[model samples]
Target: MKSRKTRVLAVLLVLSLLGAACSKSSDTKEKKKTEDTDYEKHSMETKESTEETTTETTEPSQRDTSVRPVSTPTPTPEPIPMLTAADIQSMNNNNALIVYNEVGNVSTIVGRFFHRPVADEDDAINAIKGVQELLGLQTGYFPFAVYGERFQGYTVYTYQQMKEDVTVTNATLKIVLDQEGYPCMLQSSLASNLDYTPSSPTITEKDAEEIVLNNMGSGYRVLSEYTMTTVYTDYAKAQHCYQVYTNSLIDNASFDMPYIVHFISLDGEYINAYPTAFLPTDPFADYGQDSYFKDMVPTDYSFTINVNGNQVDITIPISKNNVDGKYYLCDPDRKIIVADYYSFEFKGQLKFDTQDDPNSFDAAHMVNYYYYTQAYDFYKEFNIESTDGFGMPILILDGYCDESGRAIKNCCNMGIQYGWSVFAATDGYSFGHSLDLVGHEYTHGVTFYSKQGVQYYNEYGAINEAYSDIMGNIMEMYMGETSDTEWAIGERSGDECRSMSYPYKHYQPMYVGDLYYISTSPLSYLSGLDDKGGVHDNSSLLSHMCYYLYMNGMSLEDLTWFFLASIEMQTPNADYDDFYAIFVASARMTGHEEIIPLLSDYWESTGLKGPREQTAENTTLEGYERINIPFYSAKVGAYCVVEVYSVALGGRYLYTTMQWDGIATFLAPADGTWFLIGITEFSDASLSTKVSEKWLNHDLTAWTDDPNDLGYIVFESGKITTFPTYQ
Candidate 1:
């Protein structure tokens, strides 16, 4: 039996070896199949490559068959055509539009253009018809052309139908809207004919001249001559002349008496007239009549007239108002008239000797001359006449004019004593001696007149100063003088004037140091200078704030709004806070509500603390809400240290202690959740209240034992809770 088992085992072992051999043989067959497959694929690739090479070799030109070259042709641009005046005129004529060739006739059209632009062809045609209707011309088939290239281009348009339109006439000017709703004007001659109906009078130019000479006297002489031309259908020209004459009664007269009359004629017809005395009407009426010149007469006089185009310049000489007072030759009557005289070249200067009289020519006179010359030049350019005889006076005084001390002191004294609001240099300061000061003083007068009798102080005072300052700057800008607008009032005063841009630049003891605490005790003591009874001191703040706003790009409108609000809303005794509130309210009123948040943010950023309120509450066991405490505390640390005053609902008053330990944990009570507050240092009872109350000790051992656990502890119904210092 043993031998048979051995034989069986041996056979099994042999069979197992045979199976392993068979498995190995199968694996080898698969590997060989994979290698043969790879070899066959490589062979196929090589055969394809060979075919490609054969093809390339057979036809070398075929190798360039990657892509076909594209041929792009250049594009040609279209040309723009030019237009001519004749073409434009022809187009307008075909359109049946009326044309205005004379430039003067286009005045009405230009006025309409200023008011409104043409909307369409209908508007343009209607404008032409309107002009014809005004001129009482036949409403025939009239086409009007508004040559866009001006009258140089003959553009015409026809009005198919008349449209109802309104007409506005001002004096000799007539404006009409055509069927197309555009305005047009009649040529000057036609307009004159329509304006004035001529009777059966055959008046020749020589006859008209004779009539004018008879009426104006033999002393009159023609000054300037001009030819007025107009083009409607054809050009019409008319001769115009300006005549001047010196009246013997008023001629060669001094300031006290009226000067000679000067008459002007247009085409041998009297048009307008005036006298040399017209310019000094105000000064004559005010001072010349009373103390200065009681009985003044003319000694000797002569006249010289220059004529150019439509302008005429007349120079006349006259005696002084009095040997004592100053001499002036002015034309007051013609001041308001828009005469053709573009300018008056007053070449003569008033001579005064300091040796004869000390107050002969003072600084005030020089200043007056400056202002009068300025005002004269201003109106001359615009052909504006001084209707009110409100020409500024020039008083020449002889002496060394100390603009610094005397003028400034005088202004200040006058302003304070008589409420004059004088604007003069501070000591030797001339930079501030400008038109701005004058305007500022005048504005003060106006304000005083309007407001009755209101004294300025606090907010009102600040506003008053600010108003004057702003207006002063504005007046300077209006007069085209900005060079002297720096904060310095009078650098010429050596050291007398106030600095506008930088008050501290003066090194005034009051303005030195931190601006906010300048008024405080220690700082104030350090700077022992009294700020002009606190006026200058407090006013600096206002000026500084205004400067800040100005630098920040506040517009004139914004400044005006702020000023209005400040003056209207401010009380007599308002402080800085009141000023702030008024400013905020005014900003809101003026549709600048966004400024409120910005202002608040600015205050906070400046480290200024504002008002705040706080409250606390507790819940009852019945789950009802109740107000338990009303206490306030500054936000401190990680938790609030609110003091408990009294309990609202009945509960155990256990004084328990708790702590944050190494990690903070929460403890729940029957009513509310209590947090384990942490402390860094400890303090005794008396010291606790004196220092901070957050250092009190309480139980929190569990949290410290396994702080990483981040676990919480629940206090029983009657257990007390207190906070201890963190270990």
Candidate 2:
């Protein structure tokens, strides 16, 4: 286990890699505007150099050819040419896949590519630069941090993306190097362009701080040190904004008071703010007022205690202070401690602290101790040291209260900076009483430590929540007393708060773009405070995919292992498309390739994947310059784009609005000889136009004089005369 200072420094390093643009202070003192200005101008370098580079290649693994055909690549000699988007697209195989985000960004790329192992940060920079030039990777996206790790005898390097010395949320580039240090795969979600202009802000950092403080109301304040200028995409538009990281000053505030990001524009105008904290269950749900207990793992500190309204016999481990000679709710082996919020103490040799059997509220502490240990033991199976991976003591504060002394009626992981405290209200059926809930909260810590810590907002955040619910339910199935409640979350609390199998029953979307599907529009999300951009509501979509496989024959243990192993394979902003690619990669990497077809088919059914080419009908139309292209956007909620290339002009991009009626109207750029290509947008990533080969890579002269040519569309006499059948 690492020391506290070491752990703090490591997390700070991770946060820096996470592109935390500002420094947050634990101090309560108010910061001046001048200090904030200085803070914003400072830049921290995160690159390191090495001396040796590796250049080698090995045989690729077998893949499931039935689902997607595999194509073996012919080895290339030295001095590989730079990669183009089209070149990358052409490289797709059963083992490799490339996914584009909305607005034409290369959101995800998985599979091996030809390259030598980068010896250091400089080599990595050059490697990225070569690809960036071809991919049209825009300015403002620069590497701020690079980290290397050994996996399966291979070297994997991950680079964090920053813009103008500020962190760009969820943008990253990952490069995988094989045993001999040769490039294996490259994955990225960096921004594609600088559509938004960058200029000097009209307001100071202190003014932005005050705006956020005022928005949070009286009891809240900004973590000045954590505050920083950041680049965030609100819906599809990128904005240079100030991220005012704010949280409650109260010691035991409810989970509802999780850390919030108050986004303010350069002009000092408030754009929006939402909870940035990650938890298991829906923080917005109205928790039921009941609690119960199950069989316990008996220990030396045996006691008969009342849990909610029922009596249960349980035993647990606790520690005794050496000097005071009094027992406290602390365990040394598991490195966990429970604190009583009411007395502002750690059950420390005060009021029944030594009592073998405490009652009423005191019993909640015991319940927490028991279930927390249970949760810890479950994670221990996978060999996780603790939430911090440093054997840091797990701290639990029972009976959290607000400023008015009212029970917060919630639980949350207060983050590693706060000593990894998991606080819950002791009123009614406390959140800590249920093993699943405890596991749910504990998994947040696991995610925090995972290789690509999923952000707690937008698409990735939804996935993060789903991960908790999935593991929480899994823990109940394996550890708790046998029962019929297998796919239900918070079942021990009397109300089946959420149903993973039947998500719609609890008003959550079972599939993307369903009845309860929440929009990611910045206007709607910020004004309505819609669960941090619908993370909770949309989480079920991904969770349902996992549960669907589990119910369709995958063993519970295997499902658990796959999901656990896949976490470290993700990037910060990875969405549904990225998950699909990463999951398939994990299955192949972990010898679970048989499940790929099932997973792929399920994703397609849910609209995450699409057919690459839609059959086209050769038709001749009259007197119209617009084409009514049919697209499958119902499940994805995306818009389509058409790229027309002319010999006289390099290429022209055209846009259109998405219609729910399953048709998109694309207008041609005027009467001319043009070659057509198509693209569409999903919530996170985009898809290329489904078209046959007759329309692509053809000589303009082949169709220039021939009206019957199916390869090109001609607009003569103010009307298109030839049209291809489109899907």
Candidate 3:
């Protein structure tokens, strides 16, 4: 019902994290930090399976009063014996369980407990062990937690098939079985024929950490252990006999590097790491090419501006690469590649000019804005120089058509891009209409650039889609949408596409357990456009998780930081688990452990689980306060928009609302006074209001007449002012 269209819209009117009703301390005082906040009853426990995420919670809302409760942890069920290899043979019905399936050269195995009287985890362990013995994987390295609940539902477990723990070139293993003890499938893969050896680590854990830190050159906090029961070695490479585990941090504030791994040699030598920083130096720097026309957006320098008469350097070099041609390519600027698909009109005589094709003219606008906005977000949001943190020029193949368009299918509506560097979009008339959607595509360029590349079919493919959705929605939330917009893709449909808050409302799952099918085939990817390997659809899982975190007080800046910083920790085909483990480690590195509970709760709500896990259950955001900002205009029915931004974790647009009621009420992001302003107008351009005594004339005194009072905000003549209450 919220999909009901609003005739008028407003934008960029913003207030500080705490809305109108809040008053400043007027005196310095420290705030409290929590190892665990009393967030009981607020965690997302969804009551309905059909609920939408944007308007839903993860945990259920109502209790089933009819059900009996004699709480005793259900007596831990009865203890069952761990089975042996011979025990599994007695149960095998000669089913051809799927062997290891290779994904990006990483093999995975699957099995199902198809028999009646279901078996438990112990039985599953015995079955998998026997199966592995049959496949001759005993010599290979299995996961340290072979019996851990790696996957949800039907007693599934996964172990990485490491060719060599040191310089791993290939790894894979996964098994799915039910309680019935029937083996469903088993998968494992490794491409390297390189010999591997298990060795004893001579280097002390403390020494190895120091060696890795010294070789890597800063921006890392190390874990205590060598991260192994025994030393792991990749005999294929020069570096062998090393310790492998995610980097941990005791103090995380200054932590800012991407690689989640450290391959430390047992002999105190440096082998190889998973991701080296993607800080490719700018190649467009002067190598004796100084050709500047007028208004050229520099791909290489910072533009200076006087903010409140204070010189503030903002980096935005307007491009002189705006050439009116069949397709203008930024040559010397190798990082930026703009392929104008075509700009011709069929009006009697053929024309190759963009002016002739009105749509084509719009295309140029869309792509240019794409570059500009993305540059702004990457830099301003995460201090990321460009699409690639290393400042890679965005590659855009634009002017892709709408009605009967030809080119990449997923790139158009689903935001599912296929190629690396190259990004595609229909002119503003088709797909590029939504600024955030275009931002979404270009962000894929960032992710691809960061991942070095991405897979477009499996979970990696799904992650690609999810990242696009996450960034796109953020752009739309804080930067794009005038009013509260649905976390949907493209500019075409209304309330008809994927929903972020309520993915279920749009027929998508918010967790891995809800995946469409366990086994997959090429048909899933090749099945015409939208459902590419269920990439677009299944992506709602991560997207929903992303949105949930944002809703539960995770600022855009932190989310962006969490995302951008966590990139190097991923494989070309990383899944939710990969994200989970790395996120916990990285959050600790950044000293954001307080929010880990929030992140962990959302992750588990979606059926993914991990350690140092924190839970955030904001059923109704109970503890957070609110300010009902009031507004007035000589112009009746003037759309009033408000944005509440939080600076606690760097600046982030935490809440927004647009209405004709001349009022916008919002949950204060923190415990303090909030500032209100309209940074931009409906035209989507900055609406500047100089900061002076006149701007601060609005009332900020809090009403303490009632002990059980929240707060209120009022605006006058376009400036924020206090007014009367409604309650």
Candidate 4:
């Protein structure tokens, strides 16, 4: 049993050892598994942490999802307030504000208000500011007042304001006052918040008449009564004021029996009224009140009378005065009426009676009389208060009985031969004695003044005649004349005057062909019989040239190019050839390429060439020989030194010598090539046979067209022997 117990104990011990061994092995395995799992978990955690840190550090703040997200913020806007009528009205009434009335009673009222004089700038500014404030302008801006002193009673105020925020931006206000310091009108312009509403002025017909009567106090005579149909507008009223003020007269006799009234407005509309009967004169003794009537008295009748060239015929009738009977004619009874008869031609007989009735004479006669009287009055008024204010001496021979053709021929001959200016009549009896005759003669005077002694022959003459014809046409147009009338002399007289585009229409052999021969001669004599200066034929050429130039879209300025050039450059005795040269050079110089071709064509058409050719080249002067260098070098100290020996014929040599550091430097040999040189003065060669010497020395006869051909020396053996050199 003991042995069995021992064995059991041993077995127990073995069992215990086994149990302990099993426990140790199990714990070790579990610990190892836990450690391995922990290690793996820790490694993963470390890697994740490092990756997160790296991402946080490398990513931009905006892109970082970990940070807070951003969004666009909305901006707050200011509110626009509504403006009330009361507010606007209050603003309009504000003394510090300015208001502008574009239309209606407001304008009239404002005009009347401004008519009164303000004491000072403060008063003016305050008044204008009141208008501005009433106009609803915000603060910080004011209106200024403008007063007219010349009109005696004109005033206006102008102002400006910012539209968006009631800010006063700009303001201008004016007040016009009469000589009596009474307000005539108030004018204002301003920037405002309120839109404008136009209202018509409440002025009745009786009220207007009353105003007129009140303005023309006493002694105001109504020579004639007239009615004007006007649209009821502010502009019309203003114009009416001007008309009434300027036209009213105290007496008709003060205006020479026929009291004429003219109505003109700032807008250029015009009207005239005349009294048909003699005016009543005041018989009261001369008193202090007479000055009032005198102030309102009208001067002589004035009118801008336009004669109809088509319907009117102008005739200067010559009377039988004993003053060189062939040259002058006068009327003692003034029976030879100077009348303007209108129609295509002069069809009425000459009337020797003097009748004021316009219907008794032909339309031409009446129109002519009206124009002459008007022109006379204009001249008189122009010369009223001066010595020789009528611009030189002008003789108006009225009631002269002479043939229109004869008068024209005499005047034209006198003018061309002795510079006499005459206005002749155009009766259909004589050829070439038409409006053109007067126009051409008149143009000579105009040209003399405008151009001041312009060359007369060839192109200039042609242009002159053409311009005269144009002026004639213009004058006809001014006289309300048209080509439809038989008075179109250029079209009627077989083209003697001028055509619209062609001047050759008048180039008849009898009139022009022979005239050219006599005129072109150097010693050409004039016969006082023809209108042209013995060159009647060539005038057509010049006129035609001008016509063509005008037709080619050339402006007056462009046309003046040739005129200016001719006047500036042409010699007194310049002929057609010289004219051609001048034109070519002028056209080129003035940068008028279009004129160049035209000038060329003109020259060619006239059987002439244009300008001469020009050649340009560089020349050099070389030493004659080795020893000749010192001789030339010695000349460097002389007064005249040869610089360049030009090869062209009539070549000019440039000579110059200057001192450098008190040393005389020689520039003759230094040109064209680099060379050593000492300081020396310079002098030009006195040799007249320079070309001959050069030719003999260089043996340049091979290049000569003639033995005397001494083309400019370009270079002398590749060394500058012509021009002086300086170091």
Best by lDDT: 2
Residue by residue across 214-329, what tens digits does model 2's lDDT show? 55456776666556677765422456777777654423321333566677887887776655553211111112211100111223567775554666677788555554555666
Model 2: lowest-lDDT 10 consecutive positions: 33-42
- Candidate 1 residue-wise lDDT at 433: 36
For residues 609-700, write the lDDT of model 1, one tens digit per residue.
12100000111222222211111221221222222211333332322111111112221334554323223221211112233333222344
Q: For model 3, state the Cα shift of residue 97 in Å.
A: 29
Number of clashes recorded per candidate: 69, 11, 58, 109
Where does model 4 exceed 4 Å of error? 1-422, 426-437, 450-467, 470-489, 492-500, 508-519, 526-534, 555-574, 578-593, 608-727
lDDT of 2: 0.53
User: Cα lDDT of all candidates, in order?
Assistant: 0.27, 0.53, 0.38, 0.27
Clashes of 4: 109
Model 4 TM-score relative to the real fold: 0.28
TM-scores of the models, in the given order? Answer: 0.28, 0.65, 0.39, 0.28
Q: Candidate 1's C-alpha lDDT?
A: 0.27
Model 4: how far residue 377 lies from native, Å: 16
RMSD of each: 43.3, 16.7, 28.8, 44.3
Q: Show model 1 residue runs off by greater than 4 Å.
A: 1-364, 368-410, 413-466, 484-486, 491-503, 507-529, 556-574, 585-727
